[model samples]
Target: MKIAQICPRYFPDIGGVETHVKEISERLVKAGHDVEVITTDPTGKLNRRETINGVKVIRFRSFAPGNAYYFAPQIYFYLKMHSFDVIHAHSYHALPALFAALGKSERRLVFTPHYHRSGHTAFRNLLHKPYRLFGKVIFSRADSVICVSEYEKRLVEADFRVAGKTVKIPNGINLAEFKHLRALQKDEGIEGKTGKEKTLLYVGRLEEYKGVQYIIQSMPELQEFRLKVVGKGPYEAELRSMAKSLGVEGRVEWLKDLSRRELLKCYAGADIFLMLSSHEAYGITVAEALAAGTPCVVAKGSALEEFVDGTRCLGVDEPIKKEEIIKLINKLKDMKQNSRFTTESLTIFDWDYITEEIENIYNN
Candidate 1:
């Protein structure tokens, strides 16, 4: 099968969608399908084409307020020329999906919204009207809507009113890469903490909606652990100030964008993974960390709960408090030595199995 994936962002600009595109495309290529990705030029310089990890990638110029949502004519023009059995558009904000439908491509169109609106504050919630209007246009034209989680499936039905076929396929990870990371693991034990201190890791954009502040607030009480915050975003300065004001600056370690190799090291070195997002259509990082044999604690009432069961991870309430965060961290710290349970639970999300499931979807 020939597949064409359209997304607004790609590699060198790491995020949930970018990682999703890379993981899916790499698996598709490995499964004997020809996969091509079309994304925006984050550098603002137009490049005709490039390839990464056996997948062909094409970039076009686009301008927008955020790095992920871009306004450009090139995307529409590019779709008119390419032909494939499957044209999968990721994210609901980008206009390219609607343009591709306007082109009237005979190929099956699959739209995965990666819907995560709940995390936003009241100010951003007002934009839902436009988002709903956009959804009505594109989802109505789609052959199917591929939702990444059960929560996301409900969001599509309730919010978008998508009449087309809907399927729930959870986000996946490359388990072998994580296994390789385990082989090169390094210890990062802090001096003041005991040998039993667990390293808590948070890897993703440090945006306000991500609930990084809640984790920072937990640090004073979770004195037996160290927190490692990875990735960069516009709210870095404010988050840093919050940590200082909370008097937990010494307990937190901030890291910008990390290479894939460096990321796996963080995963392997850590005892537990923490993702305290206020909203998540699907938290792929939680799945990845679990696959790496690290226990995860994510927020409840969101898509992340669909990926991690109680055996591998714990789900805390949204608007999480410092006491709740500390309690959960202590629970995970106690189970860190349960190697058999962690390894067995995460094996289900290996890339090879995930790729096979997608292959079956395409074949159908």
Candidate 2:
């Protein structure tokens, strides 16, 4: 079967949706299905056509103001001309999926809405009131609507009143990539912290909604731990200033351009993982931290609250005080030290299983 994965962006861009489509598309290719990714390039710097790991990728030039909305009308024309057995569109936040839904092609339109409900910013949030009308086309036309988390499913159901088929399929993590890091196997418990400083990690886009700023606000009190931030975005400057104003600049390491191996190591080595974002359809980084047996402190109102099972994870609300975060960090350290951690439970989300489930969906 020939499958088309439509998304906002693809490989080298490095975000949740980008990585999701890449993982599934490549695996579908390896499974002997011809898979192609139709995405947009706002900067017009990437190639228009290329093949990575046997999965074909076609990028169209788009107009993305403030790196939001990713308007690409060319995608509609392309899908209207071409045909595929299955056309899976992703990211409800971007416009390409809706464009794919609007195509006249009779292909099975499968949509994976990594939906965060509202927009990422104040301006974008205001646009959502009108955008909700356009979103109806994608939800109503889809043969099957796939949501990445229960939180997303609720939002999609409530806002769109979708009458068609819907299913919850969470994002998967590559546990094998973290196997050698020994985040689970190592016996280095409380003893490991005896002579060294704990590394607090924040690995995602530097957005204000991501709550990285809140972490910076609390940095002045977390003197025994240094921060390693592993992504770049518009909010980096603000976070840097916050760190400097609080005199924690030297302790906060801003990291970007890390290879997959380096990132896995960071997940495995960190004492605690922080993702205090205001919203998340599914926390892929939180899952990765869990796969690495790292303790996580995520925000409560979003899908991330699902990770808090009183084991290796904890939750806190927004508008938290610096003292609260410091307390949470100390609690997570003790929680991890007292319990036995393992990656065995992470097997349910293996890419092979998830790809097979999607294959079954297409086959049916």
Candidate 3:
């Protein structure tokens, strides 16, 4: 089967959606299917073609930050000239999904709108009415719509009124690298420390909506623990200030643009993973943390909660309380006395199973 994945962004520019597309595309290719990705250029070149991880990747021009809003017309143009067994259009920005639907290609159309949009984005909010209209058109045109979580499926069903056709396919993780990465990094003593400390890890964009500030607020209350924040975004300075104001500035570590190996170490070495995102279509970091045998605190009512049960994840209903965080730290410190942290096999959500579900979708 030939699959053409249309996404607004791809790696070297990282995010949950990019990671999902990359993982699924690679797994499909490994399964003897052809996969091609259409995405926006990260180099700002807007060039048309390249290959990454054995998949053909095509990039076109886009306006940074807001360019994701206009990917539909570009995808429509690209699809007119090429062909695939399925065109999987991703994102909830309305543009790409609209074009993929409007293009009306003979092949199957599957829309996986990762739906990570906040109720912000002035243009998107202002044009909500027309956005709904366009969304209905695109959604109705698709053979099936895929959601990464039941939360997302419900949102799509509620908003788009496409309840019957939507399906859930949870995102998967690659655990091999994460398992070995900490030992490698510890040997090298990266982050200016020898081995894993009592650490709290945060990975993903440093954006306001991600609610990273909640973790920052919890830091002053956590005296012995170090907070390691990974990924790049616009909210760095504000977060730094919040850390300083809370008097935990010295313990806060800012890591930016880590390679895949380094990323695995950050995940593996951490005593706990934290994501305070108020709104998440799906949180892959929670899965990665689980795969690494690092327990996590995923906030309640978000999609991340679905991937995590109480045994491996602590679900907080609001910005994590200082007392709660400190208590968790103490619990982890106590658990460290044992050789292992927490044991719950997450092999079920591994890429192998996830790809099988996706293959089933394609076959159906």
The RMSD of every model to the true structure, in order and in angstroms, is 3.1, 2.6, 3.0
Task: Name the candidate that leads on TM-score.
Answer: 2
Model 2 residue 134 CA deviation in Å:
0.4
Model 1, position 282: C-alpha lDDT score: 84
The candidate maximizing lDDT is 2
Residue 121 displacement in candidate 1 (angstroms): 4.6
Tens-digit lDDT track for model 1 on 226-253?
8899989887899889889988888789
Error at 219, model 3, angstroms: 1.4
Q: For residues 225-330, could you state the per-residue lDDT of candidate 3 as single tens digits?
A: 7889998788889999998888888999999888877787787778788887877888888888777767887777778777556566777776556567567656
Clashing pairs in 2: none
Q: Model 2: per-residue lDDT, tens digit, 1-364?
A: 9888999989989888988898898899989999999999998899999999999999999888887888999999998888788889998888998899998367898989888888899999999889988888898888888888788888888888873577888888876776666644354332223338888999999888899988888888887898989999999998999899889999999999899877876787788899999879988999998877788888899899888876578788767666778888988777656765433465228777788888888887
List where candidate 2 sits over 4 angstroms from the true fold: 183-195, 337-348
Give the range of the ten consecutive residues with the poorest summed lDDT in model 2.
Answer: 185-194
Misplaced by over 4 Å in model 3 are 64-72, 116-130, 178-197, 319-324, 331-341
Candidates 2 and 3 compared by lDDT, better number: 2
